[model samples]
Target: MRAVAIAAAAAAAKARRISGRLHATSSVRQYSIMISPHLKNITLTHSDSSIYSDDRSRPYGQPLAVPWSANQIRFAKARGSDVRPGNVIERKGKVYQVVKAQHSTQGRGGAIIQVELRDVDSGNKVNERFRTDEIVEKVFVEAKSFTYLYTDEESDSVVLMEPNTFVQLDVPKHLFGDSLAYLKDDITVSVELFNDRAMSASVPKRVTCTVVEAQVPMKGMGATPHTKKVLLDNGITVQVPPHVITGDKLLIDTTDNSYISRA
Candidate 1:
């Protein structure tokens, strides 16, 4: 509770200053990304030269080499070229996880780093572009394991607890998207944190799902591999092979809800 209050106060106090300092570059953009049903608006701009990257410290566009661990935080300033998907950054005093990043070169405008960022607290998202040479405040976050607790519908967050210490965190639910359906009690989730705050979370790449109700395939559709929609215990309906029947277990790709194979 104390930490939440401090973070909110800090964000509110500095929000105006960050906005005042950043003029929407003719290139800056605002985006409303829906990683979940709760995402909201976004805005961004570049900081002044004072906070630009220290070129001599590292080569341009080199990715961070940190490994995953618990309760550790590392911070650095790097050029936009060095940013990548899954990296956490602070904009307007709020932290965001980079969902996607792409490098593009214009015939004359030099290199641009296009990024999609998701707010760690609100699940809101934004898209912004940066000069390859522009300095960005990068929060080096690493994934730590936590046990899936349950969703707090009122708060729109998922509760998770550290395995050893039992410390709990409320991660924004939107980070999970449709994959949230795969969550089961005591399941392990990978959460990326900076300063003990969750910036992103993911479930296992594969999950076991039960075939509850499989629709019969029509004989007219032939040649192609036969598939039919089957409901899972978690209430998700996905296509499975014709042979799959009620009570059968199947491995599902959590990333895209695709059927893998019989489990």
Candidate 2:
């Protein structure tokens, strides 16, 4: 999210903590491909399985390191118009994850795709505009399941663990933003990775949270269905129907922190 850009800058500074080791694998077949012919000198190659090449002498270019231990990595392509949040794309010799994408029309000029991108390496953010139909290198990554351990406020990172191996990872706390309140101890979280980079973290859309406080409704508080602001168990405030009250467990949309239904 655009709001998480501030947190991304701080998270990318630390060398991530890891618990498991992955061994290198044998060589695989590789080929060269480019969407545009103007930049044919770039020698980045994509193998059926591996994305990087061991050799760097070729005129084409050095490929990215292959994730040998994990078989969930995937490769794909998308136009700038189709780009959305969390899509990892490479541009100008750097890889970035899309944080926000907006489309606008400029009278007779054409459609412009405006995007906010966060660097995969440094978490630095940049705004760029692209023409519609421009081919973009999109890498579809798979998520690794981890158990929510705790939020390490001192380090500004959230700690997670592998359910099977118990290996722990400390991710940037800002990555979760306000949604951090929905996290509970030992909950399953999906972390997406690209070339060992933590692209994003997400929780289930709906989470059961108890209303900690709310005012009783009187007359028509709202022109339509009356609503009231209530505090949640995790210290997040949300607007809910007057029927909701203290001690009521209601489903909340973690994506936007909105009230869903009584749980």
Candidate 3:
């Protein structure tokens, strides 16, 4: 009887991991204490409800956040290692993707290397941060260019056209957030696609736009100058200096939508 129960428990654990439905739960511990010899190397399978006895209490579909710290990641030395997609390895207790590797450098750094990385669970790309001597694992991230189409009045959504293709994808307005302010008709945006759908999009790091409105200059604002709210042509409002007036062109940083300088 005990052996049978242990076998069942081991089977449950394997099932939970595979389904990705099993979250950390104490009820899972009821069967976790048992280990069956045959189930030692068993692979997890989806639809295994026996994995977590606490399923009734815990939320379903919550992803486990794996943390990877900066100190733990060391650069991989070889460009052609087994850094393939969907391989999870631990570096400094944090996990990162082996997105893509390329060799190139501007005139200054000689032929240095670059590796794009993505946080596996959060699905965010960490900026290129490894040195040329460092070898890192690869996680596949799909990239494609899409042309801005138009937004829907009812759904408050926008559309993008895939390059070289007639297919259009409907993207929610909230996903673009402030970035949408700068988008013009037919503007091209770099999109990161995962599992055949768009996950993230980015625009140029810097862009210049004409200010639609600026507040009046303040009295005795001091030599440093006081900044006030200014609306741009795209309808996004940013803080600008007191001297800034309507129809003034200014360069802005797209990274945070902060004002840089007059265009």
> Pick by lDDT: which candidate is best?
1
User: How accurate locally, in lDDT, is each candidate?
Assistant: 0.75, 0.72, 0.61
TM-score order, best first, reads 1, 2, 3
Error of 2 at 146 (Å): 1.2
* Model 2 alpha-carbon drift over 4 Å, by segment: 1-77, 120-124, 218-225
Question: Compared with the true structure, what per-residue lDDT tens digits does model 3 show for residues 11-112?
Answer: 676645544555533343332222335333333222334344444433443322323322232333344334443333334555554557566666876565
Give me the displacement of residue 6 in model 3, in angstroms. 46
In the predicted model 1, the residue pairs found to clash are: none
Model 2, 1-263: lDDT tens digits are 87567544433322121101212243543344332233222222433332223443434334433244444435666788999888888888887889899999999989989999987666688999988888888887768989999988898788999899998988776566567778898778888877655677778778888888877766855564577899988999998987887999998988888888899
Off by over 4 Å in 1: 1-73, 218-225
Q: For model 2, what is the error of residue 259's alpha carbon versus the real structure, in angstroms, after optimal superposition?
A: 0.9
Candidate 3 accuracy as TM-score = 0.44
Better of 1 and 3 by lDDT: 1
